[model samples]
Target: MLRAAAATHLRRHIITQRRRIATPESIRAVAVDPSGSLTPRAVDLATLRKTTGAPLRDLLNLDIGERTRRQRRACVLPRDKAVLLQLGGLTAVINADEALFFDNGGEERPRAALRRIGASVEFAFQHYKAPAFELAVLEAVLAEVSSSFQRRRDLYEPVVQKQLREASCEFDGFGVDGLHRLSAFDGALMSFEAETRQALQVLDELLASDEDMLGLLLSERRAGTSVDPERHGVVELLLEAYHRRLSAVAGDVAELRGKVQAATELGRVTIDLNRNNIIKFNLYLSMSAVGLAATTSIAGIFGMNLVSGIEEAPLAFGAVTAGSGLVGAAVVAGFHAAMRSQKSIEQRARHAADDREALTSLLANMATVENVFDDACRDLTRPAIAARLEAATGKKPSEREVEILFDIFDASHNDKISLREARSALHRGDAHPLIT
Candidate 1:
């Protein structure tokens, strides 16, 4: 009797602990019934498994683990008649007649995604008794994902533009704060790009899985049976629409990355150019110091008590002063000339490299043209070439500069420049290329 009583007590304690573990604070969920009414509830993973009738393995897959480390994935189980979507911290599980959302914290209750799904469900209720609700859920999820990405992009793009503008205006005056800000922006951009890419990949996978499931359903149909147009067409159209939307998000991300890269490159070049100027200035200062020291040494020798007889000669002081002055001036002039020549060489080398890169870009762009050519050479007009040059160099050249470049590249005296002529001019290194 004592042992049986102890066992009963233990069983009651275990049930109490389970209840505590499944408290509303730990997990929040909402179920959308066929009637489009939402029933909010609190359920742990164990209760979720029991309610959904999903197997242990499937329920384990829903475990979001550390929210920060969660990966985006979509799992469609045709046999179990369940669709699972995990987007960062949010998880959505859709069954045949009901959809359940599990919020593991971070996002607000009844997320935009959930609201979208709810709206779609309500709309479907008016048309058919049993709509392809899974497609609607998928579409809603994708739309929400795309919308979130766009919002983030909108927030980031303006900041990026503002930073770029500020950096451009004060490029030469960039201090520690400016550099730190640039680094922070770079890190943010990298993180944003990574997240956008992951989101895009998840969308692609979900769409592909949906299509595969559709194909499988079609294959299982009776031979020579006409497929339901509404069922298949709606799925195709929905997927295509989301695909385009997500693709645009991806394109925006790409554009943002390009701008970030340009900003980074500009900062790097500005810093390098400033450092080179400082080094040159220091070199000039050192040369001047050496010349002054040489003149000072001559004056010191004459002032010594045991001076040479030349110091006592008539007009010797004036001659010595003139000679020392001449020597110092000659030394300064020689060093200055040498440094100037070195600077010129560096400038020429950098210009040559930039021209070669611009030529390569022009040729690549012209290669995309199918039939537009003149005398067996792919040619681009002045404005077209100028745009390509700006893209390649990340700096826009003035109209006069573009005109000059076009004249240089147009060896045949034609208004348009050909790829062959640009390439030849850059390779020969004789033509003066436009400095970007």
Candidate 2:
């Protein structure tokens, strides 16, 4: 009896020593959810608005682990759950399996730390890219305007509407349509940033070539500037401004990309629409020909003198004339019937022509606007592509400049410049891009 009692007391003591588990109700519920990637675990960084520490980039690029070692532990509490963060260079992963702090008090493993950090960084990066892209696009556009203003005002033709038209023309992927698509937050922000920087460099060069000229054009809203002041060397001044502006605006590669895409889409849609119209026009043309044939047939019958006998008899002329009148009326009716069909067909053809012309005008106008956007975007990123094109073709300044100018023009290597290209290129760069 004494031994059995002793055994029972020992079992009770062991039970008392066991640690009691603690968890917030919310956390308990999270743990029960089976849909999470971490099937055996659950954590909510988003929920831990107050508890999560700042991004751990400091840990990511560290060649040595010393920096993270020196830093204090980052602890974040999402709702009722806490994340105890330890950094590995470039990652901040969570240790979801830990029910509580490891009782043995071992240092957090670096590998595990990295995975959590990566998850967080990926989240933050995903969030940051779109806003950054938007910001970059705006900056790029501003940069283009700045550079182009400098060119047109300081270096080249400021007064001519054509100059303005040219400056405003272009088509590239990143043009106006590009801006539309830029809201998509991809991790391409870095690429955008890189392209922007390159464009800025080119703009700097162009601006430096004629600072005074650029100053004037860029400040056209000049609180006090005269119209037709007739500055000496105005041609040179305009040239400088054009180059600077083109270089700057063309720097935003994304705009170029957007414009190109927009133009392609615009081209496809417009072409398809136009083609359909052409087919309709042809169908109408066939109808017109058929109507003309019928009209000709009615006129031919009138020429045959089908009721000449009535007109020949003078004594019976009045009655014959009356009968002839009936015959004439029949012929007139046939002519009118044929004429109506012919007229209808002709009218349809005219309408088709008018409709096509209107659509053509509209498409052209849209394309011009697209061109402007494309030109601006291409110019922003001109120098880098210039560099690439240069490298591809041995970097001859003349050759490179041509390639650069072509990019501004947004023309294919084989394609000649359109009025749109001319305007875009002219507005952005030297009006006399060609010496001729």
Q: Pick the candidate with the highest lDDT.
A: 1
Give one clash count per candidate, in the order shown.
Answer: 0, 61
Q: In model 1, which regions exceed 4 Å deviation?
A: 1-26, 51-58, 65-79, 106-113, 127-130, 172-176, 206-212, 215-234, 306-436
Best by TM-score: 1
TM-score of each: 0.56, 0.20
lDDT of 1 by residue, 1-436 (tens): 9999999999986675555446523466788765666778665666656655567556555653213333344444433346666653357777656677775533333333455557667777767665556655665566666665564555456546666677677775653124434555566566656766666565565456655545323222323565554455556566678668767867876787687677778888888888999999999999999999999999888768665688669999899899999999999999999999999978876764554454333322221111122112246887775665554334565565555455455789879776666545434232322211
The C-alpha stretches of model 2 lying farther than 4 A from their native spots are 1-256, 305-436
Query: In candidate 1, which residue pairs get closer than 3 Å at backbone N, Cα or C atoms, i.e. clash?
Result: none
Worst 10 residues of 1 by lDDT: 367-376
